[model samples]
Target: MNFQINKDVLLNNLIVAQKALSNKTPNPALQGIKIEVFKDHLVIITSNSDIAIKLNVKDSSLDVKEEGSALIPGKYFIEIIRKLDALKCNLSIVADNMLRIEADRSDITLNMMDLEDYPELEFSEKIKSVKVNVRTLKTIIRQTAFATSSIENRPILTGVNFKIDANKLTAIATDSYRLSQKEIELQDTYEPMDIIIPGRSLEELTKILENNNEVVELHFDNSKILFKYGNIKFQSRLLEGNYPETSRLIPTELPIRIKFNKDSLATAIERASLLSSRDGNNAIVKLSVRPDNVIEITSNSPEIGKVLEEVYPVDQIVGSPIKIAFSSKYMMDALKIFNSTEITVNFTGEIRPFIIKGEYDPEMLQLILPVRTE
Candidate 1:
């Protein structure tokens, strides 16, 4: 395509579109960014097998000399533009399908990929779509996506389950050992729907979203979901197969609940994990509530010394004394996402899973399954 645009504006949008650009794909076309030029604006498209992104660039600095389209090597094009010190850059296709880049003094040309090989992408919006607040969407992803299983053995568990019933939207993710769930209220009601989106896709989408009061339009289909925000359209392929029923996994009755300062408890666990034994990457740490109501976090390794850290409960512990051992990494990950200063850990039993909730973080829960210890 032939166009002239401000350097910063083009570079910024390229960074966002690059999230979907494939580096090691067998298809070479996926490594190229498709640039569509119109009289008023420029459109950039990038996609891999799992996700795709399309963003429109309309700025006062944009001056279109001609309207055309080209598939340029994504990596080389972005790097050439980024290194240019000029205020504006001009991109045009010359003879032999070469993309010529010209700025103040830098002149470079990159071999263009075949436009015929580029897959046609459809970004059409659905008739009825769900709208979610930008900040709330980010919150949901930040809180739940981390808990998705990274292992590929259980492929279904590698995605976050999204369920919509009326105005309520619930997102749940678990890696068997730990689980995270967050719910948010939509402005308008939508028909019941359920889907699983890959955690990696959600994580990449979240990075491109801005924190604001803007509403994100969600268009859903049977196999793919599209997120329309501002001038950007992000699409991702949904995971196949039904997600496991997670409702029964959560305990309805928690006999013992203890509130603790989030920072204090996290720090104690971090200290204990320093000398603890490991199960894979999990550093096991023990939490105990004495009859006197005092709490202790302990870790021990025969080859290393032991650590015993005392932390007082923010509120009186409920029910009988209990001791539980769990991975310190999982607990700290769940704690770091909380917005509240204080958090409550509800325990069903020493061996059963316990959940953590925050007063400020309504409708969000983090659960950890305890490990057996001697």
Candidate 2:
């Protein structure tokens, strides 16, 4: 392919497309990006079999010299574009399967992959699409994706479960130890869907979406899900299986409720966790509800030291006093999701899973299971 494009424009899209590049794949073409040059625009596609990204650069952004196609190594090609100091870069297929990049004082030629060997990514534009606000989608991922299981022992838990019922879209993620759930009211609804999206894919999608109020179009089939926004189309393969019914895990009645300042509680827990160790299975923080409407957070490490901090709740403590121990890391993860100044912690009992929720955001719930301590 031959084309003259603005350095920044090409670099920006390359950086985004690189998110889907497969590094360890045995297929040589899968490790590179396929560039298709048309009369009006250039298409860049990258995929690792599980996740794929296709970006379009309009003719207005580039000076098309010839209409052709080429497959360039994603890693080296992107690096060259990023390092180029010129405003515009010239790309040409100087020889069969060889691509050359020329900018101001720099000239480089890289061996290209065979386009025939590249995987054909089938994406239909006529598929059913759903519109969701970018900010809302980003918030949903940020709040719940972190709680997904990192290990693949249980493939379902490694993805975020998305359930669409009427106008509400609920996202839930859990590693059995803790769970994070967030719900968003959709502007329009047509059908209900229950699908599990890989956490790693959602995390990458979140990075591509803008933080503004624009809308993103979502399209999905039985196996793959597509997210289209601006000039980019991101597709991910859905995990097969039924996600665990997380609603039943939430307690119906939490008697011991404490509403504390979010910042105060987070800081106390962070300080307390300094003495605990994950390797020793002692990263536990004890929460003791005092009669004086104060909660004491304490952590003890036999090899290290101990820490104790008292935090007063914004609202008066309700129900009887109770003491519970949980993973400090889990508490910190839940706290980081809340932007509200005040948060509520609901405890069903000393051993049962407790929930942390923001006072202003009732749609989001964070649950942490208590850890056993002698």
Candidate 3:
């Protein structure tokens, strides 16, 4: 295979394909980026055990002399191309499974991996696929993927559950202590489907998606899911097991709802958590609505000191006065994701899970289970 292309164009696509390149896998082939040179375009594929990314490069700067395929070491290839000072880069297969890289006044040779060892990844898109705006897909992943459980004991909880019914698409993630859910309307819909996608995979996918009106077609089977963008295909393995029913967990009768400025609440929690020592669990902070309707955020540490921050609600507090203690980090995580200036924290009780919602962000809610402290 021989090709020459604009350095920037080649590097940009390679960087995206590098997301799926595995570093610690048993199969060394997984660490290489498979490059397929065609008559007019180039195909780049990278994969691990969980996620895979394929990119089709058809740029004006591309000059293909021959058509073939090679598995180049992903890390070294990307680094060499990135550091190249030339505007155009030339890559071709040399003798004895070695790849030669030539740029402005630079020469490099890299050992290519055996293509036979790389797993065959099928990125075929089904006729029945769901279309979602790039920005919307990115928003849902950003809002929900963080709540996925990091613990591997319950492997299913480490993924975001994606469910489609008609034109509505819902993404939900939970770590047992906190849950994040976002819902958006799709432009077109087909069959009903539900799948759990690893949170780590979704996070990696979002990094490649640009915020725009471009549509992403989603194709899925029982075992895996594929996301097709303009010229890129991202595929991830699905988790096996049923996700816990979480609709009932969000309290419907939230009698105590208080609206607060999202920034103010976030900063208040940050200040309160500052006094908490990290030797134990996450700092547990108390949020209380005083009789005077002032919101007070307090954190106490016996070995250190205490912090109290008072904030005014955006509007009058509803229902009776209440105080709830929860992990400061969880509340901060929920508050920072809101796009709205104002947010409401709704509660069913002090011990039960309370939800945070924003008026500007419709069909999305963040639920955090309160921490109990005597």
Sorting all predicted structures by TM-score, with the top scorer first, yields 1, 3, 2
Cα lDDT tens digits for candidate 1, 1-374: 68999999999999999999999998989999999999999999999999999999999999999999999899988888888999999999999999998999988888999999999999879999999999999999999999999999999999999999999999999999999999988889999999999999999999999999999999989899999999899999999999999889999999999999999999999999999999999999999998778899999999999999999999888888999999999999999999999999999998899999999999999999999987
Candidate 3 vs. truth: CA RMSD?
Answer: 1.3
lDDT of 2 at 259: 91
List, residue by residue over 128-174, the lDDT tens digit for candidate 3. 88888898899999999999999999999999999989888999999
Give, for candidate 3, the lowest lDDT window spanning 10 residues: 275-284
Model 3, residue 170: C-alpha shift (Å): 1.1
Model 3, position 298, has a per-residue lDDT of: 92
Best by lDDT: 1
Model 1: which residue pairs collide?
none
Cα lDDT for residue 162, model 1? 96
Best by TM-score: 1
Q: Using lDDT as the measure, name the better of candidate 1 and candidate 2.
A: 1
C-alpha local distance difference test of each model: 0.95, 0.89, 0.92
Candidate 3: segments with Cα more than 4 A from true spot: 277-280
Off by over 4 Å in 1: none
